[model samples]
Target chain A: MEHLLPLAAALPLVAAALLPAVAWRRPDAAWGWAVAVGAGLLGIVGLLLRRLLQDGPFSYAVGGWAPPWGIELRFDALSAFSLGIALVGVAVLVFSGRYAQAAVPPQRRAWYYSLLLVNLGGLVGFACAADLFNLFVCMELVSVSSYALVAAGGGRIAALAAFKYLVAGAVSSLLVLFAVGILHALTGSLNMADVALRLADVEARGPVLLALGALTAGFMVKAALFPLHLWLPDAHASAPSPVSAVLSALVVKLGVLGLARVLPLFAGLDWLVLAPLHEGLAWLGAIAIVAGALAALLQEDLKLMLAYSTVSNIGYIVLGLGLATPLAMTGGLVHVFYHALIKATLFLAAGAIIHQAGFRTLRDLRGVGRAMPWTGVALSLGVLAIVGLPPTAGFLGKWYLLLGALEAGRPGFAVALLAGALLIFVYYLRILNAFYFRAPLREQILAVREAPLSMLLPVMALALLCLLGGLFGSGPVALAALAAARLAGGG
Target chain B: MRRLLTALALAIVGAVMLAGLAGLPRPGDPAAPVHTHVAAHIVAHGVEDTGSRNLVTAVLLAYRAYDTFGEVVVIFAALAAVMVVLAPAAAPPPGKTAPPPSPAPAVAPSPVVGFVIRLLAPFIAAFAALVLWHGEALPGGGFQAGVILGALLVLLSVVMGRGLEQPLVPAAAARWLQAAGPLAFAAAMLIGLAGAGAVLGLPAEPAWGRHAVLLLLELGIGLGGAAIILGLYLQMRGH
Candidate 1:
């Protein structure tokens, strides 16, 4: 069980390698293998959660090496919580196995699954990495795999989207690497703890600040923070549904987590200078929330609408982090988890709809709810969550975030949060209205069948969890609070 | 074509000017005198810091490993992008099919060019190996070694038809090798971590372990570099 932590990271990676080889021989088996791997990851994450709850934190030295000298695999509450979110997201993505088989050509399916698995492995490795170099390598693993996955959609637009994503991702990676190099130069260490320990005596504020700026800028780009989010809509909209699910759900969270890692490192810096950065970030997040929702409302294409919604939701996470209260941090962390589930479910349901109907525009989806009831219900639940309605995880995250903002005496941010929530309601309700109220545009609605159980099961499971997460929010909230505390340099 | 040549010429001249401003020194003999302050500083300080005999290896492997990593990733990103862009939209045509033959008249390889490539291949390989092995004690290291390997392959591709070379270095294999190199470097860092308590943060070790770790890391770099260059070549050939 203790060893399962490393296995959680290794399993998907090993599976990725094995997938291409075996997939050529047995195409049918590939989906099954991917689902099985997803299930295994869920199980591993569950075990890790149990262990984390029982123990304080877990550390594994890969190949039995010590820290600052060897690669250390650390699993504290923060990592375990993030890993859980990733696992849930992966499980939702596995729902696409059926949709993919039905929609995509057979030959492309194997590479798609391989990229997803590789992305999963990279993220898991990122969550557990205690070394800076390992983090960068894992980040690249995730980035390159994501770019390929985005391009795998097999369209001219998809290729262009991939190119945009590649360029942005490369620039972000270079910035991150530059920061890591500076950190190494300043501290003569590549280990996170070692760097932290060494920075106590370093008076070279200029370079340190530069490194922080670079890291922040790079991560903001990756996280699609407002003005730096140019590449995101195209990449997300043009990507296949499963890839969209994973990208919006888990990949962006990696950037947020990177920010979390860097925040503690710079805690000792002058708050006056840092205050502006946070204020700007908060403003960006608020604007993004409004801008993303407005943009989403204007979109005819369902996928593009969802992509903008992602940008908006990311704003909530960053806004909460910017608020800098314990409660806000908790909200941010919990949003990372809740958003993964909600977004993945919605994306999966959307994929299912697209697979069955071959329609992508919201107007084209009129009366789809009647045609595919289960998918409709799952999608509706996902919408409710995103809209921050009751008895769903989405509401609880916003509730905490808004409360944190108020508690921090930033009524302006509180208003922004409320406005963002209202905008989400407007857009999400539009989706629901289009699905349920509008007349059927296609005559084939009578013959339309439900998505395969493989797809429906994961969506329903996630939707149910979303409800359960809101109702039983205390457990995760407490865990996230603890994790946030740890991240804030608490014991 | 004329405009393009003029633009290229202007770009080269501008680059040279910028390099001059940066006080860039000319590539020279190892034992030759370096008159410039920067060159002298590099020669004097680089050996102690990097423990390499080849000044180029010293700078690449240690002083500027971060830039080297970026260069490697750029090549890798290019390869990945090409594969994604060019992967068949439908099932690939079956059999070991060649691209439709070019209509251009065949020009015989220059006798001098053939002789030069044949002459340089072994010497280049030997020099690359020397650079890699003596990286800690000299200026040349993994990056230079990799460049040399790429240059050799380019020579081969020029002398031989792309079709013949394509079989020897398949695109897929190049992709794998490209991926494997960074993975290998990462693995070595992980291995080094086993002794030091952190990945890539190797301890002041049992002298042997330190050397072993560096060698392994360099090997990963070489493997990744060679594969990436090969992948690029294949892509450029539109294989």
Candidate 2:
């Protein structure tokens, strides 16, 4: 069980390789194998979490090389938590294979699953990696796989969206590489921990600050920070449902995690140099919160509206980080986990509704609640969570964040948080009203039925988790508090 | 459209040439106050720390191995993406027989061009091998060698036509090989873990283990690089 950490990363990769071979011979075996692999991943993640909590951080050295020389995998509390979110997301997505098969042709289905698994493996690996280079490799793996996955459905628009994503991703990679190079040149190391140790003094230098700036900017773009979020809506909305769920849920969070990791590395730099940057990030977060909610409100297409909502939710996480207090950082980290689960649930439910009902627009979905009660119920719960209603995980994150903002004496940010919550309520209420109160669009309603149990099972499980997470928020809060302290150089 | 593509290609090439020329630093001339210290640090510790005879490989594989790893993954990812996005469309129904392969239009290649390609193939292959084998002691490494091999394949494809090229390396095999590169590196890293109790672990007998690991990792890199380049080339050709 202890030795399983490496296999958690390896299994999906190996399964990815084996998928094409299986599809080549037995096409039916592809989905079965993908499901099995997803199940295996969940099992592995469960085991890893047990080990992580019981035995502290787990480290695996690749190629028998020690730190500062060999690549390393570290499963600390933070990483394990993130990996849990990603693997659980993959598990839920596995249930969507039937829909994917029906929507995409048999020939493309294998490739889609292959890309999906590879992307999943990449995200998991990125979370666990201790080496800077390994993180970069994993980041690219997720990025490149996601681009292909986004375009796999084969439309001219999908292709164009993919191309844009590729260009943006490429630019981000270049920036990251440039930052890594400069850091390596400065510290003579590629190990994140080693670099941190060596860079304690050197981070005050102009070039080091420049490198940090580039890295932060690159990660900010990847996270779809408000002003830089231009590519996100098109990429998410145009992609197939499963792909959209993964993109909104997991891929963007990688950028947020990268920012968190790099922030601590620049600890001792003059606050004046960082002050403007922090303020800028906070301002962007506020704007993104308002803008995303407004944009979502205006969107007629169901998926695009959800996509914009993701951009908005991400703003809260970033805002928590920018506050830079211990409580705020913990809130930010907790949001990463809570948001991944909640957002994935919401997106999956939305996908299920779209697939069954063919409701592309909000107006088209009139009184869908009466037809598909389970999906509607799950969606309503997800929306309630997103709106920061009490006893929901979303509320806990916001509560912590609002408290942190108040603690940091940022009353303005607290106001933004309050406004954002109200906006979420309004939009979600609009969705609820359309689903439950309005008259049914008869033709669309007739086509709708309860989503497949496989799909509903994952959605319901996650929806229930939104409640569980809020009820038992202390466990994650404790872990996050520890990680935040470590990140702030106190631990 | 052809003219526009040609113009765009030429502009990109021209810009690259200008950057290359403009960015070249003068030999032994310290450009900045910081360069003096950096130069001294490199001179003092570079050779001793990195076992590679070639300073570039030492810098690439040893000093900055992480960047190289990232680069390798990036290329692999690009290839995987291309494969996923452009997988062959569904086969026609059973009752509908597929159309026959298009007849090759014989446009005569220039005799001089054919001669150059034929003459260059073996030497290019040899040079690529040399670069790969002597990477630790030369200006070139796996990436450069892989590119060279890919360039040779391109030359062969251009001279011999697509049919012959397909036989040399089939699409399926190319995809497998591309995947094999990173997997191979990962395998080598895993092996390192077994020997030294960690991935990317250099054994206590650094000379033997490091050399073996480097060679194995490079082989993966070469295969991956060649396959990805070929895959992209084929995708562009609408294969």
Candidate 3:
């Protein structure tokens, strides 16, 4: 069962290698090969998930060596993130098949598919890595592919944006490596569990504290937390839509995952020490929520609006975790999946609209709903869900988070949560108004047909999942509680 | 004011870090926790079980080869990224076709420099191989060998001119060479299944097979790394 883990990460990579060479002769079939690899990954991940949950968490020691001497791939609540990440990979790749034709040219499609494969492989590896250094390597695979993917379809602005992103990302990655080196110096082991144990025995809490600070600061940059998020808007907005969907829905979450994995190693510290860190995080989350929404509210381009909204939504998740209650952390965990589904649906629907209608601004895209009603429905549902309307996937995460804030005696954060939701509703309303209430600003929109069935299927499927997930929120709620308990309860 | 704020923030952070670091044991203390636990295990059992006289080799190749595998993939990703960046931009369909691929012109090297590099190239090439082969028992390993080989290629370019690097292996061929590291690592990992050991774990019973696989992996990585280093320099210095 443990052997399946390496295969899940490797299968995509092997395909990534074979794809360009294979597609040299067949261009249309390049996507098919990628989709096949994605499907295989989903299957492998499903079996691993079942084994992981049933076995109540285990670690696979790489090279059959014991911990502290070998790298380990852990199976836990955080690692289960691989399953969700893989699911997103399959959905986005399926959407990209027909949709990619518009954005990426035929000459670059093969390279695009290989880059996608490498990206997914990196995500899976990042989620499962139990050794700190292994995590960094996995992240490099992710970062490099994503940087290239941004500049992929070829545009001057896209190249500039990707370079900006690369600078911020590379700097943070180096900071993470620096922190890991500090921890290795203090603990003498690369395995995360071993590091935690050895640190408990060490006399110096200073290096441990410093490591935690560096790791958190580094990841905050990656996560695009309010202040350090300058690169995100351009990178997410300019990249081709399929790449945008993954970057917005999934990539930044790795930063959150890094915090989840590393910060807990220092949880053994006294409340007085840990409180300020969480408190500071909570403050940052609050500011990010308001600031991200305000910025999103002002964006003229539909895609840019959605990009900024990601920043706001991430604020909500970070705020939930910052509250540091089991219930709040559970809310954050539930948000990870809920937001992934909602954001992916929204981006895919938006991409279809842009591809079919040939407009990116809200004013130009006005009344596009009349021509493409299915995509309109998906877009409306996504907007409503993102604003936390009832009977939608997005409501439950905020509900629990709000409850957690009140329970934690931080009624102020609860107020901030309400304000943030209202802010989200305001910006998303602009989109809804543009789609429905306004008349078509351009006559060309009247000639626009529905997006091809290949693109429409994933959008509607995700929209349907949102409704079902909302209706059956109990199962996810329970799972979230379990994940939160496992994380906060300490290993 | 902004600079003042920045400096203030930096000072606070640095002070906190230094305070925390002071609590740590002195650097390189043999009595430290890191030295006692995992490091101790490797020092004690590395040679006998892993069959690598060098403790670093035992650790890198046998005990934690999986991490090394990931590092291989990371370098491979760098090469792939550089290629995609240097790839020709898409031509508009029917409106305009992409320019035809042109053979890049070679830059001529100075006579003295060329003579010197030509004279020294073989010794470097031979030494790189020795490092690659003796990595198990010596300080030099795949990375060092790879660096040596990359230097040799750089020398070749200077001696024989710019075409020496690209013509030695085409961009198309260099990509395959670059990917060889991860592919070889994967092969090594899958072969470990015969012993039912974890990924990249070699079996003790088949001692020769174990050593042979390790040597193969080192050679593969060294070759792949050398190719990629040269590839990156050439592609970045585009025509």
Best by DockQ: 3
Write down the TM-score of every candidate: 0.80, 0.86, 0.94
Of the native A-B interface contacts, what share survives in model 3? Answer: 0.55
List the global CA lDDT of all models: 0.73, 0.75, 0.83
Where is model 3 more than 4 Å wrong at Cα? A25-29, A105-107, A270-272, B1-19, B92-107, B111-120, B154-166, B170-172
- Per-candidate fnat, comma-separated: 0.05, 0.33, 0.55
Q: Could you give candidate 3's per-residue lDDT for residues A1-491 as a string of tens digits?
A: 67988777878876786576677666788889999999999999899889866886777877788777888887776777787678778989999998878788676788788888988988898888888988888888889899989888678888999999999999899889989988888878889888877667666666776788889999998899888899999999999898998998889998888888887677665532677888888889888999999999999999999999999988988897789998888888888878888888888899999999999999999999989999999988888889999899999999999999988999999999899999999999899999888999999999999988889988888888777777888867876788788678765
Tens digit per residue, CA lDDT, model 1, A1-491: 55565566666765664564566556787788877887777778777878888887888765343455345677876786555555565565567677776645565676677667767877887887677877887788789889988887688898889889989989999989988877766665666776776666566566676677789989999999887888999999888888888898889888888888776776654432566777777788888888888888899898898999989989998987787788888898899888988888888889888888888888888888989999999999899899988888898889888888898899998898888888889888888898899897876665678888888888888878877779988878888888778765523
Query: How high is the DockQ of candidate 2?
Result: 0.26
Candidate 3 vs. true structure, TM-score: 0.94
TM-score of chain B alone in model 1: 0.65
TM-score of chain A for the candidates in order shown: 0.96, 0.96, 0.97
* Best model number under lDDT: 3
lDDT of 2 by residue, A1-491 (tens): 54566566666765675576567667777788887888888888888877877888878754433566556678886786655555555545565666786566565777778778778878877888787777888888789888888888778888898889888888888888877877766665677887776676452355576577778878988898888888899999988887888898889988888887777667654442565767778788888898999999998888898899989989998888888778877888888888887887788888889888877788898888888999888898899888989899888888888988999899999999899889989988889998899987667685688998878888888888887789998878887887778877722
**What CAPRI-style quality would you assign to candidate 1?**
incorrect
